[model samples]
Target: MMKLEGALYPWRFRVVLGLLGLMVAAICWRIIDLQVLDHAFLQGQGDARSVRHVPIPAHRGLITDRNGEPLAVSTPVTTLWANGKELQAGKDRWSALAAALGQEPKAFAARLEENAGREFMYLVRGLTPEQGQSVLDLKVPGVYSIEEFRRFYPAGEVTAHVVGFTDIDDHGREGVELAFDQWLSGVPGKREVLKDRRGRLIKDVQVTRNAKAGKALALSIDLRLQYLAHRELRNVVTEFGAKGASLVMLDVKTGEVLAMVNQPTYNPNNRRNLQPAMMRNRAMIDVFEPGSTVKPFSMSAALESGRWKPTDTVDVYPGTLQIGKYTIRDVSKNEGVLDLTGILIKSSNVGISKIAFDIGAEPIYNVMQQVGLGQDTGLGFPGERVGNLPNHRIWPKAETATLAYGYGLSVTAIQLAHAYAVLANNGRSIPMTMTRADGRVQDGVQVIPEATAKTIQGMLQQVVEAPTGVFRAKVPAYHVGGKSGTARKATVGTKGYTANAYRSLFAGFAPISNPRIAMVVVVDEPSTGAYFGGLISAPVFGKVMAGALRLMNIAPDNLTPADVQPAVAVTIPRGLAR
Candidate 1:
């Protein structure tokens, strides 16, 4: 057997050894090919499969009040996503993953099928951190998440018109957000990341670019004053059952819009059923004929002319005066003559028409223009209106008479407040500002002579304290003065004014001796029938002014014993602001 084995296996052993040598030689050659000559290509393919450039999200800037309280802020959120192709392979676990995501298994499977061609697909956007973690705990194969931001308004609808809101992608959609979108938006950064076959981030390799955060913005709004003004306006609007309303308060010396509020507002957080009408910023956009509110400015124009003294008398034997085809009638049918101040106190349409005819159009138009009428406040707020102040080249007697009593032209609530501010501010035309009063604030222009402004201011005070004046406009323990206006709403795109549908407005400043704050209240189409400006709007002005003056610690100029009353305890409700 031993002799046969050697003889039979010698050639076979040589053949087997030859085959083994060939195999070893081929293995060495292959190793050399992969580790040297073709190394670059193999390494490049591996890197492509494992490395990716992932983006790092940059959040929006903070919008704060002058006191450093947040009006709007960016909140962190997570977006759940999946590599649909990888996820589709794990079909049995779709129910668990879908249940974690609060979706039906069949719908989830259908969704994965729809996106099977793509490597990535979104499951849900803007999920809470807890929710994202709960879904990830299921450990489904392609599940992942990315960080994002959402804008939240702390003051809610109270600051809705000013602060605005952003879209789901963090783009500014309205209000201040839209106005300063560029300043508020940030640049996202990118980093090289290593991921496994399941598309999970393994480790960060290197940063390509750094994220740049947005700049913080500080506004001129005093949150405290804004709260008071909103509360008062809301109460009055509800009490009068008005269709809508607006109130604007200004620091006359600084031209800062301390507070501005509008009714029928919507919460920016939940805009599911938002309507454009509810989002309207009435103070800045909506226009109404200012009615007798413009008389003071007209009087200022006449006084600047020096033709009519404050004590001059005017004829008003008949309540109605015929001017061309139009007849102007006074609400109070006074049979006797009244002085210049008496006209404003009684709000006689006849007296104002006579003066408008005498002073002509230029002076009145010049005065209106000087006090920020028919002009933008330079706040750059979205949808800010330059109300219609028709300075026609040819002024008809009818138009002039109507314009004299705030009929022919229209003005926004902000413009009316700005006009009264000029009277309170000694005829200085300060530009209204939404930003804080910094070096960026513009210098005021001299709109009217200081002497004439003082004279008109005195006359406005008389309109408040006079026996036949609007007593409701006078603030207790303070030398407050304002003029009430009851103007008829004009038919849209027509010359005819609507009867019974009126806009009750009051515009003036507190502490008539040394005016500090100028405010305006407009109640549109007040339905309770007690719709006169003196009866409805003036009371709101008085209440808000009384509170604002107290909050600002302004000393009372007039401490009359009869006008003084015990201060009611003030308790600010936390919810009203936000």
Candidate 2:
């Protein structure tokens, strides 16, 4: 069987050897391709499977008052997360994690079961440093944590209205927070995370972009002044048994708001007990028919328009002035003639009504509009209201007349204060602001001529200085100047004013020699025997003004009272009596 031709045997052996050589060459080519050409791609796939993105929370910015007092800040904390897939692989691992986190094992197991197959899941958020350490000590597989921040308010309820509060993600929600939210929310950063086979974060692989914190916001509020105003206003509210109260202090030099306070305020740190009404900033939002506070504007407009003089006398009927179908009456009986200054000192509704008719609505409306009434002050707020102003075109005969005596129009406390500040600044109506910027007046648009403004200022001073006028507001050492207003509260169902409930307002500028601080105090529905501005709110004005001036280190106009004497007892005309 082995005896075959030599040529045939050799040919068959050569064929078999050639086929083996081809097979070996093919194997070598495959090995070279796999080892060299495809290595980078395989490596890239492995990296993708293991890599992750870990968010590094940036620190929130600080909020400080103008005096550099920290109002809001961020405290460092930790957030715990888990790898659902890895936790499932480790039996009872969830129970261990929950035990270390002080959570119930049953709840932890249920939560993990619900989130099975999830790549990443949060176990707990906002962990304290101590809690974080406990979690780290457990060394439980799949559990990871990273640093974060939580906002805090140092001043709490006292500064809540001004500093406002931020959301869980550190976004502003109210007050300065909302006004400057974009500036307060810093950009979050990202880093590459190294993960194990089961998508558990091992460590940060590389930082792609560093987190940038928000900018610190400096407010114009003075903490001391704010505290003072809050204390006194709260005292008065409790004394009068009022439902609530509001107080605001403005820098006369510029329309800067130094202190704005509202009662029933809520602490930003614990808002669970907050009331809806407590959150409203009444100084800027509440509108009332400024009562006698508006008399100065009327008297000023009349004197400025070259229509009346301080001594110019107008006959006021004993009881009422008949206009169209409505008869406008005074609070007290004054059957005689009253000069321009006398009308303001007496707060005669009938006298003011005659003057409003004399000046007409156009000029007064124009001046009021120019002085920032019936308009927004451009303050950064959520819901600022524009007070109502009766258009001259729509003003009926009675409406125009009533508007002169501080009726048929409405204004917020801030607007009244701003108008008084304009009078203090010698006729220039400066724009009001919340931020503590430059204190220089904005060269206010001169609504009334300088002469008219000065005259009104002199009359307003007399209202406080005169003996019979309403001397309840005079400070012992300071040269006080201001006006008192008592407008009846509007009845809900009917049209006429309520007899018992009245909005008492006293607005003025102090240190008449050189006005430093302007203030307006309005007490709504005061239950005390006296609801008139002169009796109720004017004294508060005097108290607050004296306190504010003393705090600001302003010298008194008269060290002693012999330099000035109580003028003639300018009894409030019977018609103007409330």
Candidate 3:
């Protein structure tokens, strides 16, 4: 073998050796460039695909009732997102992803086409933990899930108008949510994270910024009272076949809204086919001619004037009065004169009109304004209506007469409740609030004399005590003071009031001996059967007040009550009756 040919064979071996040497030299040069010359650049390139600044979600505030019962709260949820660029390689697996998202394959494919150009895309939002985990188990490239919040209303439609709701992105959209968005939505934080090529989170590197949780809001509603009112109002509306209805109860001492409920309400949790009308807080937003509910205010004005007395009477002979083109009439045709208390109990529009003309409009106007009619309640509700009250020192006989009997002027259910509160609070106009006061909050402005309020309370009690009065409004063992109103609805896009359509209302306070609560019930356009305040609305007031009184632990005042009196009290005045 040593003696073999040394010509072509030796040259071939030399060629192989030279090639190996060149390969070793090239490896050394590459090592120098990576370790010294371009080290920072190479390391940065490696990190570019892995390092990420991720958002750390912050929770929204809790909205609770005055008794610490949760009305609205934010629960942790998951929102799935995708890195569109990375997901392109896994297009074939999209059908599986779409199935997890509860989407049709063709629909999901079409959506992908629209979002293909984007670097990131939202896949599904507001998913439960199990729902989100099911999709993530697929391990599809570029798919990720982030924690978020979904608002939940515990009281459902019962507290819908007051608690409101948020959008998919956790933004407050209505009710108290819209009113206090800034205070309820806190700042989101950020963190440094390491992710794999598929956009899957590998590790949390460090917290870049800490998240700030939202502030908790305590509302003025009492959950027990709210539930009671909601149940009673819904039952009445359904049974009466009413177009709409509203009920508001107030803590006369604190001026706090204890319970406010509306019929045809929408559940904030599931607002898929919600109508705009269903979302209105009708207790404060919808305005109507209060009908005879405002007669209490007229009576307040009468008592405050010193020109009229409880024993005074008005002539309602034919039960109808001709004031210009308008004809005011009582529900029943009367043959004799009536006292002030009798006029209110019978809801005599003719009798009330005579009193208004006798006293002039100024006194009635002043008392109505003082008791929060024709003005906003100052509660700052989103779509609250201020109502209408014409303030003219010189009034037409028609306008003044209509004002006395609860027409020509407009008011909201809450406004009527507030006015009754002034009477319940011993003639003081307390500042109405939707938020709970700390302790012993006494905010009041005098709207009438204490003696006048007490006297009116006694007179109102007679309205519920008389056999022809609102027998339905009388709580079993409570001294209820209430007024009934049956107002003809103004024809839509017309001037005159409609005959068949009516707004039934009953505003009253319980435990007249020591008034602590005032409530108003309004049923609009009762479609079937009775539409009078004494029939539909007064029954709701009685039912709700019965439950509310017991739940609030308030003592009943009618411990030693008198028998039901005769309807007609024929006390004649010197010149006022007729």
Candidate 4:
């Protein structure tokens, strides 16, 4: 019995020892992993949990008209997001989400089933507060919202071109939006939130960075003038059956862009049906051969160079002047030895061409170039064409003659108005500006002699006052002066030009005696009875100027003319002479 007891004891002891050995081995293995093998991995997990990240978008700035009227403003909106894993675990998820968010069930289901392995997904953008509350009320797990800004244009399509539009991300897309995007787009701020072990939010850990708001921009454009310009331009476009039209009103002394309007415009807010063509701002973007309107430049060039006086007569034959293969003629039958003033009054193409040949192409090109023709005005608008000006070498004899009368070359409405403003402002050429950055007026360079500018101003006055030009473009309160331009439109599919289709242009400034403002009006392809610039564009110019004058509070210069009355005495003796 003693021997049996000893053997059993030995067996029990070996079994107990084996169990202890196994326990020690397991503990050692775990210690090695915790101390060495898995140490780096565990460290990384901790660091990731402690560190937080958030997005920052620069808030865009405010855009206001000259009168401090808000044209564009940014309003806060909610963007919906979802945690895929959490959302998938929710009961009756798809139907609840669709009902809460006002989306189709099928679409919402498809979105959930999408295989983007991301933990988060965007459900929708630009949500109203009500929509956000509805989603939160659904109690669907993992769905959340973030705040963002959506731009709003108060004046709508009326100022579409001037105000421009921004993208979904609040980036400026076109017009003033693009021009001042950098200055206006503010920096964004961010914060980190701490979450408990079960992924429940604790509190905002810290504000990582503070976001900066964008700068506000104030334009030199007057909202009232802009409205007026739009009204007149729209009416003319309807009445004339024209394809499109543009108008620019400028401050002669300051070179401020008071008003610019383009027809065929679309609402910046509703961009679903926007056409690429309609999106363009034609005043600065497009250029055309400015027919008779250019004749003044030819005359100005001659007068500036002292080659001809305003009274100097050119024996312009009854009609056409044959140059190489081209024949240029007077638009009117009343042609003779015309003085420089008469040439412009009748819009004599032949007379101007003769003077251009006398002055020579090189000299004329130089003069035109100096006066801002065929040059970019640097208005900061995208896609501005410098227009077409043939080099001295390629200028055919006919080319020179044609260009002399505002053909064979092209100029923008902005460029034309700026050039005309030089005459209105006494020969000083100021840079065209949309912003009032440094001051309202910038120093101007003298392009034409003061005397020469005055002479041209006096001559252009006849274009409004003469019987032939009496279409009601005349301003009774101010001595206004400017010329009209009519150019044939080029065919779209071919290089050939058409006679009936014309781009009518009127470039002038008012209170001409002591001019304060300059403007340019261009109507493209008017199909109505009135196609001439003098007929279609001039009356609009007159109306716009009258309104602007009253707005500026510039008292009437021609009070005598306004107040004058005829003596009304009877002529007694003259009837019997026959």
Candidate 5:
């Protein structure tokens, strides 16, 4: 029995030793494979479970005015995020989490449930740092805060239409914001990060994509002039009880828009009650019949024809004339003849029509086109309207006559201002821009002869200085020259016009000897008894130009106070004899 037990032990020991040797060999092979042949695969699997590719948000660019005043800017903000799965695991503590986040417990739980499959979800966005820190104090699992940026407009509603506003995703939605979005938006970056079980960022491993910060943009708007225009336009719109109003002031020499304002504007910072209508930059977008404002351009065309002189007389007998079927009449009574300058000063529609008919349509069309009618201002502004001027080749006699007197053609306020700027620049038409200039004057297209421009400029001065002229547009201590226009509003969805609804317009320049500013003001559908451009719009031009000149420290050409008339009181509704 002892001999049999010893043999059995030896056999069992051999078998156990062989099995242990095989197990050790297998373990060694696995270690070799993991450390050498399959190291990258194993490392990738481990990283998938713990490491993450996180986004590094970049800051947006700043927007400033010509004077370096901040118009649109971005500030750091905190955005709350959560790991839904981890948040769901702490359902028992949801009430505390909800209290910290200012949310109802049930709703918070439901939200977690809705995003149960999501690894990350936004809890709330745009929180103050204090609010975010309070959230962190809760120490709720899966709750986190991401650094973000929120847009802020320092000028608020004052520059809203120009600076515009951005959306929740930091994209510009209107105005210069949208126009130069690509130039203003930043490029985000990515980095490999190590996260803990609770989804907190443990360590940054390496940068995958480098972030590129956005470049700053400087605009041509002067905040000082912008405020002036905004305040004056609002006041005039309210005083005249008009439907709406728009005004644009330009640096005549550079064609840089100094100020552009539209009434009924919206505050870009607070867009809680934003309306689509309030987003329009009306000076560049809205088009209307310019009424008698086109007279200067027409007169320019006539002078260019060499058939009409500044002193040539046109007989406007009884202030009415008949074309094929349409009867052209002046707003006021006239029994005699008017020279070229008198025609503009009195705004005689019949006299201008006769001049347009004599010169033919092609010449007038050429002059208007050269002066920037029927063309874009090249401002690249969003929703800018290129006004309508029909091809002169197809003009009927009646249409031609109407076109001469500022009807049957459409123009925007900016277009009118551009035309006046051409005259102000002594017949050189510089391309308009919305960006800051380098103080170098660009060569421009010579639209009219310099001599002709000077003659017309003098005539326009008469429109301000003559007793029958636009007295309201006369600025103190400056030689102001402008034309007043009162055109009946063309009915929408129809071809006729409304007698009561009028678009009052005034287009002119200040310090006429050496023109510094050319501006245009349009008051749409004035409901008050006083609806003439001379009554409502001219006064606004005078006040704004006076303020602008003083602000710019421009030397007044007419220092003699006696040459300037007393400030006219426009509160009362004057009788519209015209």
Candidate 6:
């Protein structure tokens, strides 16, 4: 019995040893497969469990004005995110997390429940570093904060319409922001990271893609001029009790937009109550009939036709003229022969209409087209309107007569400013730009002979210089020449025109001897009894232009003593005069 028991025990031991050897072989195979044969697969599975491919955000570019002053900039901020499942798992930490996040515990839990399906969700965005660090110090599981950039506009609402604002994703939304979004937005990068079981990043393994920072953008806007324009436009809009107002100032030599401001502006930084209508850049996007502002172009056309001379006279008998069924009349009675200069000085629609009809529609249309009417300003501004100017072929005599006096057509404030720039630049049309000039002079298309431009400039000078002229546009030490226009706002949907609503506009240039700035101001639907362009719009032009000219160090042309009552208080200085 002892021998049988020993043999059985030995057989049992052998069986146990064989089973143990098979188990060891299987373990060895698994180790070999994991460490060598299927190493990459095992490593990948391990990485999938703890290591993550994370995104590294790149910084957005800076936006600066022509003077290199920051207009729009990106500041580093913290965005709080959470792994919903893990965050909700820590019931004890919920109150602490809610306290750190400035939320009620129950409400915070409800928010988490609402997003329970989302593994990753934002708890807060654009928190200050101090605030984010405070949350981080709470050591809440599954909660994390990432470094990101938030756009800021230093100029605030002063440059709101021009610089625009960015979305929460750091994408540009309006104005220059939207226009150069691709140039301003950067490409993100990727990296491998080791995360703890609670989803906190423990280590960065290696970078898979390097982030490219966005390129900086330099705009042509002068913030100083921008502020000045804003202040003046806002003041005028308030004083006139107008619905809104827009002003544009251009660098006549460079075609750079020195300043552009619109009243009823919104703060780009505080966008909580943003209304899309208030955010619109009316100067670039809205169009109006231009009223007598178009008369300058008509006079230019008349001069270009080789039929009218600056000194020639037009008899505006009874101050009214009938063309087909339409009757054009002067606002005030000056029922007598008036020279071209006198016609402009008095803003005589009848006299100007006579000149336009005599000159023929083709020449008038050609000149208007040359000065950039009925066309886009080529600024590429988002939502910019190409003001309506119908083809001359469709014009009846009545429409032609109305067209001659700044009716039957529409123009944006930017376009009106551009047209005045044409006259300021010696009848040369230069493409406008919102970017800084690089010392390369742009060649302009000669739309009118320099002599003709000079003649019209002299006539416009009379309008601002004559005692009965647009004296409201006169600057203290500078010669300013511009035209004013008041037109009934065309009624929406259907329209002959709104009897009560009028668009008051003034467009002109300053330092007449050497024009440096061209500006336009439009006050929409002024409620004040005095809705005349000379009253409501001209003063805005004067104030903004005077400040801009002085800021630019432009030499004042009319340096006559303030006390002296010269024959002409301000004249187009002889060197530039015809």
Instruction: State which candidate has the highest TM-score.
Output: 6
lDDT of 2 by residue, 155-259 (tens): 888877777788766777788888888878888899998888766568877999889998887777778788877877777777776666667778877778888
Which residue pairs does candidate 5 place in steric collision? none
Q: In candidate 4, what are the lDDT values of residues 1-578, reduced to their tens digit?
A: 23446474687777887899999999999889977988987787874775455655556899998778998998888898887777777747679788877889987787887833557789888887777878888878877777888899988888898889999889989999998899889898987776654355667778789889999988888889888989999999999999999999988888888898999898987899999889888988888988887777788788877788887898888678887667887767766788888888788888888888888777677657777888988788766678876666766778889878888888888888888888888888888888754355667888888898888888888877777763467886677888887899987787979868999889888886688899999999999897888888998898998898988788777777547787898766877756
- 43 Cα displacement, candidate 6 (Å): 2.2
Give all candidates' CA lDDT scores.
0.88, 0.79, 0.88, 0.83, 0.88, 0.87
lDDT of 2 at 70: 89
> Over the stretch 1-578, how does candidate 6's per-residue lDDT look in tens digits?
33545474677876887899999999999999999898998888888899998888988899999999999888889999998887767768988888988888899989988887788999999998999999989888788888888998888999999988888999887888899899989999998999877677799899999989999999999999999989998898888799999998888888988889998999888989988889989998888888888888888888877898888999988988887677788997675999988888788988988887787777788888889887888888888889898775666778788788888888888988899999999988888999888655589888888999888888888899898888889998888889999999998899689889999999999888988899999999999779999999988888888888888899878776774666956678889988
Residue 205, candidate 1: Cα error in Å is 2.0
Question: Please, what is the TM-score per model?
Answer: 0.88, 0.84, 0.87, 0.87, 0.90, 0.90
Candidate 5 whole-model C-alpha lDDT, 0 to 1: 0.88
Per residue, candidate 3 scores C-alpha lDDT tens digits across 1-578 of 44446575786777887899999999998889998987987888878989999888898989999999999888989899887777888999999999989999998988887787777889989999899999999988888888998999989999998888899989988889988899899899999989887667799899999999899999899999998888888888889899989999999898899999998899999888999989988888888998888887888888787889999888798888886677877777584799998888888888888888888888999999999898988887787889899877679898899888887888898889999999988899999888887655686888799999998898899999887777999998789899988888898797987879998899999889999899999998998888888899999999999999999899877765354555897888879876
Off-target runs (Cα >4 Å) in candidate 3 are: 1-51, 195-202, 560-578
TM-score of 1: 0.88
Alpha carbon lDDT at 42, candidate 6: 87
lDDT at 264 for candidate 4? 87
User: Candidate 3 vs candidate 4: which has greater lDDT?
Assistant: 3
lDDT preference between candidates 2 and 6, better one: 6
| Candidate 4 CA-lDDT value | 0.83
Determine which window of 10 residues in candidate 1 has minimal summed lDDT: 1-10
Q: Per-residue CA lDDT of candidate 5, range 242-289, in tens?
A: 988999988989989899899889988788898888888888888898
